[model samples]
Target: MIKKFLVFSALLCSAVFCNAQNAQLEAAVGKLTRLMVTPDSLGLDSILLDNLSYGHSNGGLQSKPQFMRSLLTGASDFVEIDLTDKQVVIQNKIALVRHTLSAKTNDKNIPGKVKLYILLVWSNEKTGWKLLARQAVKVPEK
Candidate 1:
């Protein structure tokens, strides 16, 4: 009886821990999207790793500095964003996040809408969870 009880307790603890980790990762993802739409340099910098690989749907890849510059200069202006079907998987200090992103943009004063499958890699450090890498692929129109 005691063995079974201990086993149940362990399982329960693990489940709770997993839920908590997911919540944290989700919150971090939400913050990232919000910052993208608003273009908060300091806020975005706080959550991004120093060496970030940011890949776009156009087969273009950017470093952290380049990404920041584009966002700050209204070159990649995201007017609104919506994320759906988000999934987060964590292993040790790293996490893989996947979601469908639909956004309205005004890039270089050109209005557009985009739907993308986004994959974000996050690394948990002493400070908290930070974005390590991100890649986006264009989703086919229906």
Candidate 2:
């Protein structure tokens, strides 16, 4: 009976811990999105990993420095970003997040709206959760 009780207690604690971690990760993702739209270099630098791989719907990829430069220089300007249907799965120190992104973008001085299916990979590092990789595919209009 004691063994069973201990096992159950451990499981409960683990579940609670996972829930808390999930909440923290979700908040971090939201903050990163806001920083991306507003182009906060400091926040971006903090939230992104040094070897970030950011992939766009057009099959373009950018390294951490390139991504930051694009956003800072208005090469890929986001006027608004809305995320929906977000799902996060955590395993050990890695998290896989999937979401639908709807945004108004002003890229190269041209304004347009975009809907994309996005996948983001986050790693729980010593500092906190940092975005390690991301890929987005454009959603077709029906």
Candidate 3:
């Protein structure tokens, strides 16, 4: 009876650990989306690497500082960010998140919607999970 109880406890612990990891990934993505919507460049400065690479849906690469500057200068105003069909996978301290991103822009008198499939890599930091990299591709029209 003692052995059975021990086994059950181990299983329960494993389940809770898995759920906690899932919550961490979800929170990371949520914070990132919030930063984008608010155009909070300074807030992102601490969450992304100094030399982070951004894979734009328009087939361009944006460096970390460049990306931040754009948002701060109002060059890119994210009107809305919607995440859908999100899947989070974690291995050790690394996590991969895939989701459909629907965003609207209020840029230079141009207003339009852009839909893309995004893959984000996150790393667990001493502070929390920080976005390590991001790659986005324009969603193909059906």
Candidate 4:
């Protein structure tokens, strides 16, 4: 009976540990999506590194300061953003997140609805998964 109780307790601990990791991932993704899709940029510093590399589907690149400034100024506006088909792979202190992003936005130089495959490399900092690099590829239509 003692052995059985120990086994059950171990299993419960394992389940809890796994669930906590999953929850962390979900929260990280949620924060990132909110930052990307909204005009407010207050919470972005917590989720992204100071030196973030943002690669766009249109073959453009933006640094962290540049991106934040663009969003702050009225240079970019998001109409809709849908993040789907997320796959997160965690290894040690790093994680790779791949997802399908469908978004409608109007920026100062660009305006349109776009669908893309986005891959973001995240590092498990002391806080959580902080985005370090991102690449967006245009989704090919069938």
**Strongest candidate by lDDT:** 2
Ranking by lDDT: 2, 1, 3, 4
Whole-model Cα lDDT per candidate? 0.93, 0.94, 0.86, 0.84
On residues 19-46, what C-alpha lDDT tens digit does candidate 4 reach at each position?
7877897788888887777756668777
On residues 1-142, what C-alpha lDDT tens digit does candidate 1 reach at each position?
9999999999999999888888888889989998898877898889999999999999999998899889989999999999999887899999999999999999999999999999999999888889999999999878
Tens-digit lDDT track for model 2 on 78-100? 99999999988999999999999
Q: Which stretches of candidate 1 lie over 4 Å from their true place?
A: none
- Distance from true position, residue 83, model 3, in Å? 0.7
Residue 46, model 3: lDDT of 71
User: Which of the two, 2 or 4, has more TM-score?
Assistant: 2
Residue 121, candidate 4: how far off, in angstroms?
Answer: 1.2
Ranking by TM-score: 2, 1, 3, 4
Q: Please give the RMSD to the true structure for each candidate, in Å.
A: 1.2, 1.1, 1.5, 2.3
The residue ranges of model 4 lying beyond 4 angstroms of the native Cα positions read 1-12, 109-111
Q: Model 1 clash tally?
A: 0
Query: Over 4 Å off in model 3, which ranges?
Result: none
